[model samples]
Structures are given as structure tokens and as C-alpha cells.
Target: MAAAAAPKSNAPHIPVLLRPLIAAVAPVQGVWLDGTLGAGGYARALLDAGADQVIGVDRDPLAHDMAQGWGAEYGDRLRLVLGNFAQMDDYATDLDGVVLDLGVSSMQLDLAERGFSFMKDGPLDMRMSQEGPSAADLVNTAEESDLADILYLYGEERASRRIARAIVKARTEAPIETTLHLAGLIERCLPRSKPGQAHAATRSFQAIRIAVNDEYGALIAGLEAAERALKEGGQLAVVTFHSIEDRIVKRFLTARSGGGGTGSRHAPEITREEPQFTLKSRKAIGPDDEELAVNPRARSARLRVATRTDAPAGQSERSALGVPMLKGAK
Candidate 1:
């Protein structure tokens, strides 16, 4: 196979924490699976770093279409799969390693038609797979209470009730059909963002997108699938772009690594099971000043790595992972 070239400036999106992630798992050999595969930054980096084969998985068909231009250079060494990473193990098992970058891809957010960014004006469709229920369907049909729960639980938006009330009242007059319309409604409910703060609609958009994609559920499931698929000693590295996701990954690793803290005084301590992973770092790794200077989107990125243990893989309790649940969530 031909060697993959260095990423150019015109790339769709820069993969966050790539250098640190690859460096932490150097001597990158064997078949590795990249669960996100958006922008192909990590996949190309893995190929360049010396992976014999990279199974690039993405739920978005756009990712596969974009890869066709340059992916052929690597020939059989690069394989692109279209599907959610939650079922990653179904594609390959006993894998050498796995990499999952959580949250919306920069490419998806860049295209206004995809409806991921509040800054854009497009259809209110935030479906990563381009199939199934869209953000519009949820926003226009969901109950006000459900919307509030989604905003508060998923996005941590403190004024969730106010936003939900506004959405319900506006939808009564007309269906919320576009990104900007929903964003405009949300913006009216909140104070103008200070210069350094995020946009007024950022949190609401995030919550809706998460609901539309079931990202949190898929995240925990994908992590478990990676555990089941990885061979003993195989590395699993996950790059998360938000605090909630980082917390879920941290809690999952802590429990799986047998590092879950002792139970409180009232509750009897349960015996620790055989650890499924050995944490590569006790704390989450963040981008340094140099990376922040280069990619502002990487400012909130966090990378966590662990090596699979010989113990049998098992499902983790959803409540333990800190993933918030909601109905009619979008």
C-alpha cells in the first residue's frame, strides 16, 4: 500500500489531540479500528504512524464520500464502514486497538444542511446517519416538559424550562423547521453572550443534537463494544469534546479499571471485580498552549486512554457513567 500523506490545510477538520494520542500509543502496529473516522484525520494519522490496517467507521455517509478522494492511496490497508460505532464489535473482534472521538464532527457542523451548528441556517435536521427522526420532528412534536429535561440534563442549560416554554409556544403557531428559527427562538430566551462566552443558542443546539443522535447512549455502548472487541493489551483511546462526555469516559474507565472508589459509610462496599482495563493516565489529558494556538476547536478536547485487560468484558450500568436520559429529548 502507498503511504498516506500528511494532512493538508484544506482538510475538513483537524483531529484533536492527535499528536498526544498517537504518541501515548506509539509503536502503532496491527489492525486498529477508528470508530469515528470523521475527516479521516485520525485514520490517516494511524496509517502514517504504522497501523497495518485501519477500519474507519462512521455513521455519516458524507464521511465515506469524502474519504473516496484520498482513501484509495492506502488501498486495502484502509477500510471504511458505514454505521454507528455502538455496534463496532459486530464489524471486527479481537482488534489490536480502537479509537473513538465523541460528539459532532467538524465536517458535520460545517455543513449548514446537516443542521448541527446554531450559527448556520439550514433544515432543522441533525441526524448524523441522515436517516430516522430529525431534530425538526422532535422540536415540533415533543412535549414541553421533555424538551426542558433534555436541555437541562444533556446540555446543562440552566434556563431549560424557559427555552422549552418558548419552543412550545412558538411551535403552536408554526412548525420549527429550520436551524436558525429554533436558534432565534432560543436566543430570545437568554441574555446576549458576553464576548468570551459561548453563543446564546449553543447549549440548546447541543442538547437537541444529542437527542436527535442518541449520542450519549451510543457513547457508553461504543465504549463497551470496544472493550468486547479489543484483544488483551490492546489500547483504547477516546477523545471527548465536552465536560459531560469526559465525565462519562472517566467514570467508565475508573470502574472498569477497578479504580472505582470505596462506597460511602452508609452503603457496604462491594467487592471489586477483575479489572477490564489498565488506565494509561489517572487524569484526562488536554491540549497544550501550542495546540490551542493552532486549533481553537481543540480548546475543550480531552483524551483518555486505557489498555484492555484479560478479564472478560461486561456491560456497565448506565447510571454509573453519568449519561443523562430523557424522553422526546430533542
Candidate 2:
């Protein structure tokens, strides 16, 4: 349930913020893990930048298949593993560094069969691992209120109630089996998009996909896993493509780095645990004008890096990180 990459198969595969990422964690050596190895862009760059070995971990089988062709040139320097980044601690411990690109790859999005995009008409199956109760199943089976919560909480869609109601009404006629069918249904419930605006169904589509993949849940687990897996002085670099993703990463780093201040003026200053990570920068890094000209997709991307400390890793507060959980979910 990594971040789903925007569909851009026709476009060149340039790893977002690759240049700045390398510069941020310069002198990259020792074993590194690329947690969301979408298209293997980060893994290849890490290897080229002198990492002794890059362990590429991804839940999607497509990523591994694609890596087989390009990763071969790197020989043993590149190690591919099939699993979620949430279990990264199980994959390797005492890592020199970890790089996570949360976005789904263009290969998955561009292919209509994979069903990651609303633009293309495909089965409503947005499962990143290719195994799950797919988007179609959720839409056809979930309660209207549950659907509304997913759209509002996960995608920040304002008209979630209306859309969910419409979905329930329509599903009775027939199952919402394809991407365009759902997209069109969502479009009918919302105002039309103006020039330079996103599609009317964008938020709803994103919400359904996120729910199907459990993206936010995976993201939180993955960050903690990175903390447990990394060695002291090990760097963790994350490239987030959306505001929610960035906010979660920012808060996680802030709390771990001991920058989270007291809740209120009257609140007691409690003793804090030893900081687990040190922020490389107080602010997130974004694509520059030069990079934007080459890849506009990088425009929304933000990079955050932090170095591990010797402190023992601990669970992060989900509310503190703004992770949206559906009601009735623990």
C-alpha cells in the first residue's frame, strides 16, 4: 500500500528528486534499502552512487519483473525482494540507509489492466500487491456510510456523502465493475471541472484506491519499520507526492527528532525519551525549476531526510501524524 504513482507511461522515468536526494545523503555507502522500489529508479541511483548493495523491496510483482531486465546489469549489487515496506525490519536490519518513493509506478497506472487510473477504462482493481478485495468489491459491498468515510477521510473529498449515496443506488442496478463506470458516477455527483482543474472524479478515485490498498496504514508502519531497521547514523529519505503524505512524514520526523512541543501552555513538560532521529533539515525539499521543466510530476513531490540515532525505536502516535482512520477501525 505504498503511494500510488501518477500515470505517465509515455513520459520518461526520471526518479523524482533523484539529484537532491543523493546530495542530501551524500557519500552514500554501505547496504541501502529502497522500500517502494517502483520501477527501481531509486535502487539504480543508489547503486550508481556507490552503495555497496541496494536491497529493493516492493509488494508489486510488476516491479520485480521489470527489475529483472534492468537490475541484471548491476549483478549482485541489486537485491530484489517481494514484500511490503511496512515489514522492512524483517527484510534487513542495521541498514546504512533507506529510500522510499511512495508513489505507484507508471507501469501500473499506464496499463489499463492494472486499474490504477480513472482516465483509463479497466477493472476496478487497485490492489498494489495484485491480491486483495479490490476496489470493485469494496464499492459493491461496503455500506454507504463506510464508503463516505473513505472518500472524505482518505481522499479529503467534500461531497463524499452524496457520492456514496449515488454509488449505493447505482450498484443495485449493476456492480460498479470498471474504473470509468465509477468515475462517471462520481462525476455526476460533483460540479464539472474548469480549465486547468483536475477531473471531477479525482478525489473519489483516489479515495477508493487508497482504501483498496491501505496506503496510509502501510505508510505509517513503513516509517516505523525504517526506524527499527536502520543503524545509528543511517539516513532515511522519503519522497512524498501529496500533502497528506508529506504531513505524515513531517510529523513523524518531528516527533522522533524531539521537535514536537508541548500541547498547551498549561501542560506539564514531561520527560521525553531519547530522540531516535535527527532531522537533516527543518523544511521539506521540492523540485527546482530545472527538474520541473523535465518532469512536471515532480512539482508536487517533497523530500524529507533524517538520520537515525542510537535510541530504541518506538511506535508513533497515529493521531499525531494525521493518519485518517475509518470509524470502527482500530
What is the clash count of model 1?
A: 0
Every model's Cα RMSD, please?
Answer: 4.1, 2.9
Give the Cα error of residue 82 in candidate 2, in Å: 0.4
Q: Report the lDDT tens digits of candidate 2 across residue range 1-330.
A: 444434445342668999999999999999999998878788888999999999999998878777777888999999889999999999999999999998676677787878889899998898889887999999999999999999999889999999999999999999999999999999999888999898998888878888898998899999999999999999999999889889999999999999887779799878889999999999999999999998887889999999999999987777888888799988
Off by over 4 Å in 1: 1-9, 264-271, 327-330
Question: How much lDDT does each candidate structure score?
Answer: 0.89, 0.90
Give the poorly placed runs of model 2, Cα more than 4 Å off: 1-12, 263-265
Q: Measured by TM-score, how close is model 2 to the native structure?
A: 0.95
